[model samples]
Target: MVIKLTQPPKEPKELGVEEFPRLGIIGGSGLYDPGIFENAVEVQIHTPYGLPSDNVIIGRVSGRVVAFLPRHGRGHKYPPHKIPYRANIYALYTLGVRSIIAVSAVGSLRPDYAPGDFVVPDQFVDMTKSREYTFYDGPRTCHISIGLEPFTQEIRKVLVEVASRYNRTHDGGCYICIEGPRFSTKAESRIWREVFGCDIIGMTLVPEINLARELGMCYGLIALVTDYDVLVPHQPVTAEAVEKMMTEKIDIIKRVIAEAVPRIPAEIPKCGDVLKYACV
Candidate 1:
């Protein structure tokens, strides 16, 4: 069977009375609630890739137009590998969201980066397998260079500045994104920490950020530290413990985002123009 690919619209039509959001928020794990937004409204979007993780909640944050998507869906229905990442990102792109702030819980690999701290990662090592990582894979093709940095520096600067004001925040770190619904084995965790020097580990950052780059959208991650991965000798992590930490730090994530949103530049990132010279 052959499926048709939808050409991206030059500009998305306004949905109902809502203006298209220029900024997007993708909430992960226990961060699904869009209560941080004012005058929020649920928007059901159909993308060429498929349905988004959930109905996108479009609203205003600090007088900025923003759209929020719960990465795991409400009630935490989807696991990391099961997330419709391409669709989630494409939906946001179609809705005219040129910049995205991806928020997710992560396991810390470094002692200095303790649980409850926040990190704005500068680089990501993709350790994920079996996920669609791009939009230019078939009938059309483009080779976009991610180079040494994948996350948007402009977005990261705002997140770092805001997070530093009220919480423990790291300006930069390397995020090793693993494919998992399960925690890494102790040996696997050790290899990641000792051999690769990964500062944090998580399951969802792969195709989500990669695909954003493919579409020329500015993407940034605000990592919430939920546990010390099994690599830490005495700090064994559990689902309950991770949940507890996420609960405690979720507000901090919200605060950082609230402060960062209004400060993001209205223009899209300079690197987001991948199609102009990337395609042969």
Candidate 2:
């Protein structure tokens, strides 16, 4: 069922985030939380790509308008590779979400990045076998820049600053997106860390970030470290341990989002005019 909230106030010339139409929050595993919204309503959004992973929740947090969606449907129905990345991102774009905050649970690959630490990744390495990776494909083609600056740096900075106030947060790192319904094997994990030089590992965040870029939206990821991915053969990471750790750290994630939502800038030049000279 689709539910809609009352319209928020008009954008003021002051240019604060609260005046924006929507600030999107894409929740990853153990992070489909909307409790921070004081008066949230569930809204179903049908997109040209398809239905988003689940109903989007729109509400106000820290006096800012926020839209939250569970990448995996409630009860965790979709796997990482199966998530409707195109639909989810397109829906947010249609709903006027200029900026996106992606909250994902990930396995750390570095010794310094311990379990329960938070990382705002600045770059991404996509290692998925299948998933639609772009908004423009055939009739017309356009290339969006995801090379030097994959994720939006401005939003990353806001996430880092906000998280620093509440949790141990790494300001920058590289995220590796793997195709997974299952955890990585020791060899694969080691290759990702040693060869790929990825600091954290996850399944989603690939096409989602790309699609956001195609449509000229700012995207940033807040990766919560739940465990070490098979890199340390001696320290086995169990599903149970990951769930428990993520559950314990959920509060910190909420706090970070609450503080960061209001800080998104009113405008970004990187995202502006993205399609102006890209289509060919």
Candidate 3:
């Protein structure tokens, strides 16, 4: 069942400023619990958008304060299209999280980007049809520019360095985000691979990335390649196969996060000031 907070809990006044989590990790499919967090506390946050997918888990990783949120809730109850992307990002923002590392399982579009590999996507193409893609929906509209690069380079550099030490890691790639509770058709998958030159495909990146940018928070993705998206002449991608692959490779993913957390710089250069020029 989807978890929602009927009454928002007040932030504890006893907690010091240093205790606020600076790093946020949004866990994707099969990643309900971030097994690496220590001294974890579940904080139910209520955002202007609504309840986040689940309670934000505040914990320590590598002795640094970090927050973990499961994108699909504890039981994977929310579909990609139905995910509360706005609320999720907003909830993290309220917790003083300045940088976010989004961990997701994706289907590889190219043959070389094989299964059980890790990719740090520098770019993303949003093909999602229906979802909340932004935060400034009303009178106070802000035109957030994501022109140069969508993902945070500061975080990307750290993730690339840390992930390479563990497994087969692609330094950079293009992620195509589609609206889905369903996998791609063969024809559509081929076009994304051949025509669009997309390296990876997944469902829930759009609004999450956009909202983070709007909030001026540094955001980066560490995509775990789960299966070939039907373009390769192998078994057609299935939910079962994706889950199996994520299960096998979760250890490697966790290791990357554990190592990368401590290395991410506290002040990511231009990411925090993104809204300065964005608001008209």
Candidate 4:
């Protein structure tokens, strides 16, 4: 296990940690946390790397405490490839956070996974480059059997089943993880439609998945569809328009997350410790 046995800084504020949450949520794009967590406090961490994306917010929602981090930073400063994937995960892990649930805004690649839909990705096809995806590196026993199924099946089932009972509009889809802050061109979106048959596409979720996989963390994604890719010709989509839509949907997403957050059982899954086998 790549455990950092040292104690963190004396004061979390010193490390710039704003909060220490039990559950971790990596919010993407314009979707800031709802401050739904009552009695929330900010905590800091001193990772081997520099600071995390933003200050960590820790508090309770529906009686379940969760840690919320703006994956792209609060102002969406970091691009898709530039996110400090390892530092974010390591910081969360350091905070005694055992599981992660990421919520991202994605473009629909399939006609069925349209705008205003919610998808719990069952599979990930990564095309991400220019990013570091794991902690296991160099000549050390830097290997773990990270299968393609990086997502926790049980957790995903929880999301899918809960969404099914809560909102009938939600659906499941395959997420195509690409490398970019740039939206895919018409031709690229078409390739997803014709060749790969992915239901949705997004800039992030690549290194995020792999890092979680190697770390033995139970991970799942709840992708909120903000727009159809260039494949759909309703209007010329830009970052500005996507931001507007995301801002509008913040409450809707929070409502969904708040409903789902309480359902996470107290029992921790085994995925987070799978590294023990390969590490030794």
Candidate 5:
């Protein structure tokens, strides 16, 4: 199959919209509802990568321009690996989203961070395989220069501040991105925590955050601690529990997003400026 690849229109933003969104959000599990947004409009965007996971919801939050997309689709149809990462990012990029806040539910890799905790990761380990990781893969080969720490520190600070501003109990932690529709086995969980020393584990995030960095977007994440992983002594980690906690954590996360949405900086400096000296 011959796929044509070229730079998308320069400064090409949707017509009739005179401004760029101050915030762009990719909602993972338990973040499908747009009811929190005032005067929200569902916008279907077709990108070169493919269809976005769902319609991009454009609305006002604390008077800031916010664009929201559910990475797993409206009903959470696609798994992490199956998600169309390219299109989701491209759609937001095309829309001129300068900063993105990704919200996801993760299993705690450490004892200190249990269910209900929120984390803003400073580093990421991409264990995600079998997913397209770039926007340029056709005739033109473009590389996204990145450092070890993928998430923007400036954005991270904003997220942490937002958590504090809302009186939301959140602590910064390291996030480990794993490939899965399945929870880790006990042995796998042990290796991830004990051996790898990752603070949290989740299926999505890897390519999603990486691509954000590639485009120089100020990207950050608000992680909802859903479970303690399968390593817990007798807790017997289960999908039902992840889902249950995810639903409950959604309220906390929704509050955090609502609080953070208004804080997105109107003037975007160089993308990845916070991580300027970090990536290798």
Candidate 6:
């Protein structure tokens, strides 16, 4: 249908409490559209950090309302290092979003985690530099503990269950996030795989995950493996190849999201209380 792009309400209450969506999806790489949202409308939200990557698309998926944001903006204008992580998470929080499913195109760091596979990362290593990593950087001084579990187990379970029906889905993995507008060198790729034991490699997912936690939001990642990150001999990852693979497998990602959105538990008891012991 014709999805209308409109200005956001001054406050989320202006849209009525019931209209506020609890679920948010951050679309990465080639996954701009979920292709399952019905009656979608785009709303531009402004936050203290800055404007989000793009307008948040609010719609119904599997009869539940969801907010979708293109992580890199519409034309992929922002590189991984340049993404406004704090703004994006804050914008979603302002919309009453309490849970987020971030979709990303990642390279396989291991041979078994081949291209075209789906991985729900349970752990992550941040190797990124020069990005705002937290919300409580001032008088508040919140030390949000992400040591326990960074990605929400509730959401990851749902994503894994749904994705496994369509493809080779790995229930859990360790993702290594690197600062990049560029691909990893062979030496670096080897270190991540052989030395660090990273299952997947990507540019995003560092500050984004950390920021989501600071807001007391449940965050999960559905990583689509698009290439072997130079760890596998004779197969060096390239932008064109990654893009092409993502395009080919985008349908499966859409289906997994469409199915998983409604299955996520409506009330995650401890999720909202994340900030209780975090403030200094």
- Model 6: residues with Cα > 4 Å off, grouped in runs: 1-18
Q: Per-residue alpha-carbon lDDT of model 2 for 1-280, expressed as tens digits?
A: 2453233223421122344456899998887765898666666766777788988877788887777889998888898889999988887776678889998988999889989899999888989888998878789988776688888888999999989888899999999998887899988988999999999998888888888889888889999898888867777777787788879989888888888888888678778566688888
Give the candidates in order of TM-score, highest first.
Answer: 6, 3, 1, 2, 5, 4
Report each candidate's C-alpha RMSD, comma-separated, in the order given. Answer: 3.9, 3.9, 2.6, 4.4, 4.6, 2.4
Give the TM-scores of the predictions, in the order they appear. Answer: 0.93, 0.91, 0.94, 0.87, 0.87, 0.94
Clashing pairs in 4: 17-43, 17-44, 18-42, 18-43, 19-42, 19-43, 23-67, 216-272
The number of clashing residue pairs in model 6 is: 0
Descending-lDDT candidate ranking: 3, 6, 1, 2, 5, 4
User: Model 5 compared with the native: what TM-score?
Assistant: 0.87
lDDT (0 to 1) per candidate:
0.84, 0.82, 0.87, 0.74, 0.76, 0.86
For 1-280, candidate 4 gives per-residue lDDT tens digits of 1122234544434333454445678888876556677767666655776677876777777877787888988777898888888888887777756678888888887677667677888887888878887686756665666555667776787777766554434545678988887888898888887898788889889887777767667787888777888867876568877787777767777787788787775546577567767764
Alpha-carbon RMSD, candidate 5: 4.6
Tens-digit lDDT string for candidate 3 (189-234): 9899889989999998888999999988999999999899897665
- Model 5, 151-212: lDDT tens per residue? 77677887898786654445566678888888888888888888888999998988988788
State which candidate, 3 or 5, has the greater lDDT.
3
Q: Scored by Cα lDDT, where does model 6 land?
A: 0.86
Which residue segments of model 3 deviate by more than 4 Å? 1-18
Q: List the residue pairs that clash in candidate 1.
A: none
Clashing pairs in 2: none
Give residue 57's error in model 2 in angstroms: 0.6
